[model samples]
Target: MSKRRIYWTLQIIGWSVLIMFEYVPYVLEYGFDWDNFYNALINIVLGIILTHTYRLVIRKWNWSSLPLPSLGFRVVVSALVLGLIMALINQPLDRHTLEQNLLDQPLVFWGYVLSWWKSLLAWMLSYTVYHYLEQTRLADYEKIMLTMSMREAEAKVLRSQLNPHFTFNALNSIRALVYEDPAKAQIGITQLSNILRNSLLADRRKTVDLQEELRTVEDYLELEKVRYEDRLQYKILADPHTVYWQVPPMMLQTLVENGIKHGVAKEMGGGFVELSSEIVDDVLLIIIRNSGRLTSTESTSSESGGVGLKNTAERLSVLYGKGASFRIFQEDEKTVRSEVRVPTMSENPVISAKEIRSF
Candidate 1:
């Protein structure tokens, strides 16, 4: 038997035996003495053995076995076991006590039979309760595993949808530059192509190194610079430790694109977009700030000419859920900032390596 089964069986049988012993003395006082003390001890041991056998039988035969037939078998087995136990103990019990009870009448024989049935009832009840608890425990474990599986599937779907959407926006920037400056447009196309290929490769992954994401962002900014000329400038500052941290693949690129599209691009004269990464409170903190305001109106409708930001938020929500936080708000009259915080996976070498891997 498993340790759990053995331990529970002993615990149940031990308590039941104690209760029987306590009551047997009182019954003896009522002249119902069929070796009361000896009989009670034997019944406790025999009942436990019978319960163990029943457990084995149920596991092997299956619980769907016909109820009437099973119960009949149980009752017959229990009676035989109890009678044999009582007979063996009778010799060790006081012969005087048995003689006294039997000399009076045959009523003592009926008492023995009743006691045997009572013992079986106690054993069956305890066994049933233990088995029911085991089943409940197993069911709860399966439920937890199922919930995790569903969440993982949802995360993967959101990641897949967001990646292509991000690439499409980057291509739009290159397209805008083509008519005005074919030379710059050629360079932009090259950068955009490289970014697209990397993104497509990373899509096969659940997450990538932070350094890889930063390189992709740099490529995107270069393409944007061609469109806005000197009017668009950007800076990247990353902590060495955090640069090697892992994040959802292509996540940082999407967020950086949003800062450029909604925040920097919104300025008629164009403006600088600054990206920074640091470790705070044992978490990796990323900030994307640009020279545009995030008014309440902009926050309400992401698709209201701000598909980039909307798409980024959706991806973040799906990947991290409540485990991470994403917030966009106006930093000042001329600046809007998107801040994201995700748990640091400091101990995982593979994850750490991915985070730092460059383009």
Candidate 2:
């Protein structure tokens, strides 16, 4: 039921029950006196009205937001005041209707006040504590939602940075082939177009299947090969079981491009870039071995892969937090290895041990 309906139901039931507890015993003792029953009815009506009015006042002043000490003080004071009002009204009514001199006995008058005080205090505390807990739960939910939104925005901004940087490097590779080999340049343009189209579609999604991402990476490698020719040699390997796993879009291509740009392009003898993926303990492990050395400063600095490595790390952090990892380190005197490990998505196919594919 709605809160308003629930509040009204409980208010009526609670007042009726409390009043009946006193009246029913008196009725049993005095043989159903209508005058006393009428008195009990008036008391019940007054109790509901006074408590409901107190509810309105509490809400109007937003008393639920008050500190515990201040709210406790207000609750105690309000209950005492309400108890006095109830006693004053009840004593006069009982004296006039039943010829009872309740006020003549201070103990009897104070007993009524104390009983009412206990009941009113219980009601106020119940209401206050419930609303306070509800407010705390809502605040916690909003904080979590805000944190998720900020992370999503940051991931999108990081992805945006990667796109333009990638396009610039791809265009430069095609430019080198334009005058030297117009025919190859034409093919390079087509490959670049395909890669760009895939990237545009990938932008609309947070991740894509590893199989689809590999196609984009292959196209990018083809375009780079047009510029480097026989000087650039590369290989791609993937475990068949892991091909269906999901990874951040364009991520693999960025790593491959980074390998070629920093590894092969700088070497006197054109170097090799090797990309590989395997599933180990339900995690997708991707490793790229390139013919280059990474200095300590280059591994963490912007100069390492020209924002490519830095962007990759940030995107992984945003998407997976500590569940994913990326690092580049020198594997040998002439080879640098860039490694990434990501937890497999829930939608990934059941993995089975299979032979790795090479292309």
Candidate 3:
């Protein structure tokens, strides 16, 4: 239910309870007379009006933001004023019964006001706690939404960065091949078209199928293979069961592209670039091994080197938190390996606006 509806419902129920307290006793003794009925009406009005006015004040001032000592002091002052106002309004409506006690108006007013101290304290305590919790819950919800939006925005920017860098490298490779082997360059152009099309279709998604990603990587490797001729050799090996697994879009391509640029292309005789995936105990294990000596030059190299790898790693961390890992290390003097372990999802995870509302 909406906050306004809930607030009004509580108001109605609270005032009804106050009316019942006075009306029930009067009906038991006087047998349902109009004088008692009217007196009860006055009491109900007194409770609802005074308390609701106080609610307006609380909302206007945003009392929940006040320090504890200040809020407590205000609550006490409000309750005392509310009690005095209620007593003055209620006294005239039932002065006949009240006068038999020989009480002056001042003493009578004090008695009614003091009588409300406990009830006011209870009401204010309940209201303050409820308001504070509601505000906290709303604040937490907004914070979570902001964080999710920021992560999504960051992911989009990283994915966008990958495309241009990958495109530039692919075109550069294809440019070299066009003069050396025009026939192979034609084939590379076709592959590059297919790769670009697939990336565009899946660009907005957080994840894509491993099979589709592998095809994009193959297209990239094909372009590189044309330039290197017999020097560059590569293979994509995966279990059939693992092919349909959901993974970050363009992730495998970025890794494979990095391996080709930094590893095989730099060597005298181009080396093999291998893409492999296997699932062990529900965990998807992806390994990319490429031929190169590990030079710690990844950071100061191309923007795609430091930025791309770091972007991929950060994306993995964002998607899987501590549940996923990415690492690069030298396997031998002639090979460098990148390993990724992430929880396997049968299909891409989808989140909707409605689902995000509560968070």
Candidate 4:
């Protein structure tokens, strides 16, 4: 039911019950009469009006936001006032109908006021407690939603940074081929276009299939090969079982680009970059091996490395928290290995052996 409907239902039911309790005893002591019935009806109407008015005052002043001590004081004072008003109304009625001189004895009148005060106090406290819990629940829900929105914004900003960085490097590669080999430059442009299209689509989604991401990486490698030619040799060895897994967009390509930029491009002799993936312990593990040596700075500071590496780490952190991990280290004197481990989205049938394909 709506809150307003519920409030009205409870108010009427509560006042009717309290009035019936008083009316029953009077009927037993005297007898059933219309005057007593009318008197009981008037008390019920007065109770509802007084309490409803108190509700309006509480809401108008926003008593819910008050400190506990201040709120308690207000509740106690308001309940006493309501009780005194009720007792004063009942005093004359009791004298006329039931022939009880309650006003003549100060103790009896005050006792009636105290009894109503206790009842009103209980009702007010119950109402306050219910609203307090509801406010706490709503606040917690809003906090969670705000945190999710911030994470999404941060992820978008990170993806935006990756696009420009990747595009700049791809364009530079194509530029080197334009004058030297126009035909190859044309091919490079086509590959770059395809990669850009996939990236744009990827930005609209949180994750893309592993196979699709690898295809973009392949196109990028082809474009880079147009410039480097014999200077760049690479291999992609992926397990068939892991091809359909989901991964962050452009994540693999960024890592591969990092390998060539920091590894092969700097070497006097053409260096090789190797990409591989497999499922290990229900986790998707991707490994990239490039022919290069990591300096002290790169080896020691994974989070503070090149923009690509740092951004990749942060994106992983944002998406997976502690469930995903990335690390790059020197495997040998001439090779640097970068490894990324991400949790799988679903349970898959175990493959006894890995299927590795070379490109």
Top candidate by TM-score: 3
Q: What is the lDDT of residue 117 in candidate 2?
A: 94
TM-score of 4: 0.82
Scored against the true structure, residue 176 in model 1 reaches a CA lDDT of: 77
lDDT of 4: 0.82
Give each model a TM-score: 0.64, 0.83, 0.86, 0.82
| lDDT measured at residue 213 in model 2 versus the true structure, 0 to 100 | 90
lDDT of 4 by residue, 1-359 (tens): 66778888898899899889878998999989997899899988998898888777876787867898998899999999999998888765544543444535668778889998988888788877766666665566666667666877888888877787789889988998878888988888898998888778767877788999898999999988877889999999999999998888999899888888778988998898899999999899999999988875453265326457887887787777678899988899999999998886422222323322110
Off by over 4 Å in 2: 1-9, 35-60, 93-107, 179-183, 303-306, 345-359
CA lDDT of every candidate: 0.68, 0.81, 0.79, 0.82
Model 3 C-alpha lDDT per residue in residues 1-359, reported as the tens digit of each score: 86678777887788789679867987898798887788777777777777778777887888877888998999999998887776666655475755743365556658778877667767877888788777776676667778777877877877777777778878877897677778977988999898788777656898888898888888888887766879999989998898988888888888888887788889997789998999988889999999996676655354656666787788887677677889888998899999988786422234445532110
Displacement of residue 342 (Cα, Å) in model 3 is 2.5
Cα error, candidate 4, residue 309 (Å) = 1.9
Worst 10 residues of 4 by lDDT: 350-359
What is the descending TM-score order? 3, 2, 4, 1
- Which should have the higher lDDT, number 1 or number 4? 4
Better of 1 and 2 by TM-score: 2
Which is the winner by TM-score between candidate 1 and candidate 4? 4
Q: Regarding lDDT, does 1 or 3 come out ahead?
A: 3
